[model samples]
Target: MDEQLKEQLVLEATRMLDKAYVPYSKFPVGAALLTKNGQVYGGCNIENASYGLSNCAERTAVFKAVSDGNTSFDYLVVTGNTDHPISPCGACRQVLAEFCDADMPVLLTNRKGNIKETTVAGLLPGAFQSGDMV
Candidate 1:
């Protein structure tokens, strides 16, 4: 993605931080997924008492986009309240690998304005795909 669009996506993810429903860990995370057709969907992490039922911001955004018929994505931006950029968790990486292209760009950002650029393949090398199972 272009620098301007990446900035815009980061801002959208940052804005979503306030919408997170974090009570246990108190760590708010936001994610923005940009579709191949120029659509952006933002999501915030929602914490649950059971913890296992809680969804990550990245998954939430992906789920929302998929639900709206936007499975193909170009870029994804994630933001958190830390000094350094925060990458997605293992589960989020697997979920992303399921829907995103191997070379899809993923941008990680922090409240301190730090940003890191990485790709889905970089995040999850040798990822298992549907074809592998078949």
Candidate 2:
């Protein structure tokens, strides 16, 4: 992705941090997904009373894009409050593999402006996909 776009995505993700609904862990997370067609979608983590029902920011952004009829994605940016960058959870990685190419870029960032870049395959080596079940 271009530097300009990447910066924009990071900014958007960072801005979304304020919108996270974290009444439990109190760790706010935000995600921004850039579509292949140049559209960007942002999402903030939302917590529920039932821990199992809580949704990660990454999945929220991905689902939003998918719901809007978008499947192809260029990259994803996630922001959190740690000093170092924060990566997506296991569930989010699986969901990403379901819709994104293995080589898709996953950018992690922290409130301190630190960034770490990885790919979907890097996060989930030998990830289980639908074809594997066939």
Candidate 3:
């Protein structure tokens, strides 16, 4: 992905983090996804009293896109307040793989304005897919 596009997506994730509804862990997270057609979607983490019901930022963004008739995405940007780049949760990673290519761009970043870019395959090596089951 282009540097400009990566920066833009990371900005969106950072902004969404400000609106995160995290009460339990108090660790806010946000994600921004760029669709193949160039549209962007963002999501903020939401926590619930029943922790199991808590939703990750990445999945929330993808869910919103799917609900809006989008199935494939080109890039995903994730942001949080940590030293190292934040990787997507297992569930979110699987969801992304289901609708995207293994080489899809995944930009991870922290609040200090540092970014680490990698592909879906890098983070989730040998990630399970439908074809793998059969």
Candidate 4:
């Protein structure tokens, strides 16, 4: 992705933080996914009273893109208020692996201007896929 697009994605993700429903953890997170088709999907972490039912920002963005018939992704930007760039949880990493290519760019960012650039496979090596079940 170009520098401009990357900056836009980060801004979008940061904007999504306002929409997070994080009553329990008080930790809001946001994600912006860029599809190969040039569509961007923004999502925020949502929490329910049943903690197990909460959803991560990364998964939300991927799910929204998938629902819109845009599964092929090029970039993903996630932002949170943290000391360092926020890393996606294990489940979110697996979900990203399910839809994005192994080398897809994932930009982890924080409100402190920290950024960690990595890839889908780098986030979760040996990720379990459909083939793993066979």
Candidate 5:
């Protein structure tokens, strides 16, 4: 994806993050994915009383595409209001790395306009694939 597209995703992520339901952590996060079809999907963090059940923004966006029968992400934008854009959790990283290719780009941005671009390899180096279990 081009820088322009990446910027758009970042903006969308920032907007979505403002709507996050995070009364406990008070840390709102948003994620936006750019599909191969040039479509964008975004999701905000939804926290639950059970921390284990809390869903991260990354998984929410990815799962939305997957549930709609779409795979292959060209790029993703994740953002928060912190000093740095929040990275996905271990579970979200594993799940995304499973579905993403090595070159899949994940853009992390903050309200300060700082951005960091990381690849699937960078985020989850040598991640375990389902085939490893079989």
Candidate 6:
């Protein structure tokens, strides 16, 4: 993506931080997913009483896009209030690999504007895919 588009996506994710429902960890995260059709989906982390049920921002954005009948994505940006770029958990990586192409771009960012650009395959090396099951 171009610098301007990346900046826009980063801002979108930053804006989603306000919508997060983080009561337990108090760590809010935001994600902006760009579909191939030029649709953008924003998501915020939501915490539940049962920590295990809590949803991460990355997954939330992916689910929203999938629900909207958008499975093909071009880019994803995730932001959080951390020292460095926020890294998605193992579960989130798996979920992303399920819907996104192995080479799909994923941008991790922090509140301080630090960004780490990686790909779905880079985030989860040797990820399990449908081909692996067959």
Model 1 regions lying over 4 Å from their true place = none
Per-model TM against the reference: 0.97, 0.97, 0.94, 0.98, 0.95, 0.97
User: How does model 2 score by TM-score?
Assistant: 0.97
Clash pairs of candidate 4? none
lDDT of 6 at 60: 96
Which digits, one per residue and each the tens of the lDDT, describe model 1 over residues 1-134? 68899899999999999999999999999999999999999999999999999999999999999999998999999999987999999999999999999999899999899988999999999998998976
Worst 10 residues of 2 by lDDT: 1-10
Report the lDDT tens digits of candidate 5 across residue range 11-120.
88988888899999999999998889988999899999998898999888999999998998788889998887577888988988888887798888888988888898
Error of 5 at 38 (Å): 1.0
Compared with the true structure, all predictions reach lDDT values of: 0.94, 0.94, 0.90, 0.96, 0.87, 0.95
Query: Regarding TM-score, does 3 or 6 come out ahead?
Result: 6
Error of 3 at 134 (Å): 2.7
Tens digit per residue, CA lDDT, model 3, 54-131: 999998999999999998899999999998888888888888888778999898989987778888888788888887
The runs of at least 3 residues in candidate 4 whose Cα sits more than 4 Å from the true structure, single-residue gaps closed, are none
So what's the TM-score on candidate 6? 0.97
Ranking, lDDT, top scorer first:
4, 6, 1, 2, 3, 5
The residue pairs that clash in candidate 5, if any, are none
lDDT of candidate 4 over 13-129, digit per residue (tens):
999999999999999999999999899999999999999999999999999988888889999999999999999999999999999999999999999899999999999999999
Q: What local lDDT score does residue 42 receive in model 6, on the 0 to 100 scale?
A: 99
- Give the TM-score comparing model 4 with the true structure, all chains together: 0.98
RMSD of 1: 0.8
Tens digit per residue, CA lDDT, model 2, 1-134: 78998999999999889999999999999999999999999999999999999999999999999999999999999999997999889999899999999999999999998999999999899999999987
